[model samples]
Target: MSKRPYSAANPSPDKTAKATVDAVKDITISEKASDEKKDDESKKDEKKDDKEVSNFVMPNYLDGSFHWSYERLASAALIPLISTQVIYGAHPVLDGVLGLVLPLHLHIGFDSCITDYFPARNYPRANKYMAWGLKATSAAVIWGCFEFNTNDVGITELIQRTLTA
Candidate 1:
């Protein structure tokens, strides 16, 4: 066996022996503390489960269900928009509609993702900031699309040229 390092705290052989015993006691105490912590967490989860069903409130017209319908409608609208572009080729009106619809669709999809990942219940501040940021970005995107359609060759023509090139 290797010689044990002497410390000022454990000066004598008896004290050194006592220190080893204390170390063993500490390990058991730490294990018990961890077990207690786990039990507390489980209790919290049980309480959460018990209180899962909350009292119903009056449905606000501006809730997620309202937005969910809009999301579906936007998605449905895209199929016809895309089909028209592919079948009839590009038109200024079609490009304008596509520009508006596509960004709105993308914004709604990303908003849903942000709401799912950064939920207001868990991350209130982050969720609020993210929602605001998404709004600002979506506004900017719509503006840029409007400028492109008006000032440039428009979205559908750009895509057609890009793909052909």
Candidate 2:
């Protein structure tokens, strides 16, 4: 039987080696191109992030040390205020003080939640107006509570009766 010079069953070692080298070179070139694209994409993403951060504006009330301190103090004061109302039972003075602090606390806490969910950036005028409305409503509520406490069973007692009954 005569042997073939270049058959599929008897492939040359040099040809196989050359093919393998070419495939490797092609793979390396593609990988280099992909890596450069990834680097460019990452740089673009970083620039977008920097622009967003620079443009971001925190609310004025949230930015100040005095507001932070006041919020902290109000939160701390609630513990004692609640404890006194619970243990000693509600007095006129306690009810009056609670009326002042509690409504403000509720307004601030709810307004903060509203601010977080519905940011000023999305609703600039609405956010400001909403906050003002909250403050005004809270003030009115406090005033109403004060009037009720002076005229009737008081705020805590009224809550107790409502719950029990």
Candidate 3:
């Protein structure tokens, strides 16, 4: 029996493929280092972003006389507008239904509301029940609008079914 001498140009010292394994390990380490660097950079930016956002301060409305800056009014109005959409669902009756659905806009009783029909009277039981029912139905309509893919036709038909029900 005999053992071979070392060779470098075409190395195969142990024949166990240690060099291939070492190359793979080095590649994995380099990838891990790059990932760590990315995480560090993102962490730094997150802190800087928080500081930048904190700089945009606002005073309270408890000061004597009232005033609305563009930012203030816009913020105030935006919430109710978004809520109105979620509250009432799509406007099948009119295009730009945001404009029409507002009580002030499309006046008379043609500006129908479930609130109008199921008026909140003084009775505790009826009032609570009606409130729950309306909320559930409104939530259903909003969900249905999101789930449905068709145009206003399907929604209008749905409204008709609800009205008949």
In order of appearance, the predictions have TM-scores of 0.62, 0.58, 0.26
Tens-place lDDT digits, model 2, residues 1-165:
986699887778888899899999999999999999999999999999999989957567657555666777888888898799889887889888888888878877887777888789999998888888888898899889889989998988887788789
| Per-candidate alpha-carbon RMSD to the true structure | 11.6, 8.1, 20.5
List the candidate numbers ranked by TM-score, top first: 1, 2, 3
Off by over 4 Å in 1: 1-63
| lDDT score of residue 155 within candidate 2 | 86
lDDT of 1 by residue, 1-165 (tens): 977677896487988789899999999999999999999999999898778756566666347886788899999999999999988888889888988999999999999998889988999999999999999999999999999999999888898899999
The CA lDDT at 51 in model 3 is 95
Give candidate 3's whole-model lDDT.
0.53
Error of 1 at 152 (Å): 0.5
Deviation of model 2 at 159, angstroms: 2.3
Q: Between which residue pairs do clashes occur in model 2?
A: none
- Model 2: lDDT equals 0.85
lDDT of 1: 0.90
The TM-score between candidate 1 and the true structure equals: 0.62
Clashing pairs in 1: none
After superposing candidate 3 on the true structure, give the runs of residues whose Cα lies further than 4 Å from its correct spot. 1-13, 55-104, 107-165
6 Cα displacement, candidate 1 (Å)? 77
Model 2 residue 44 lDDT score: 100
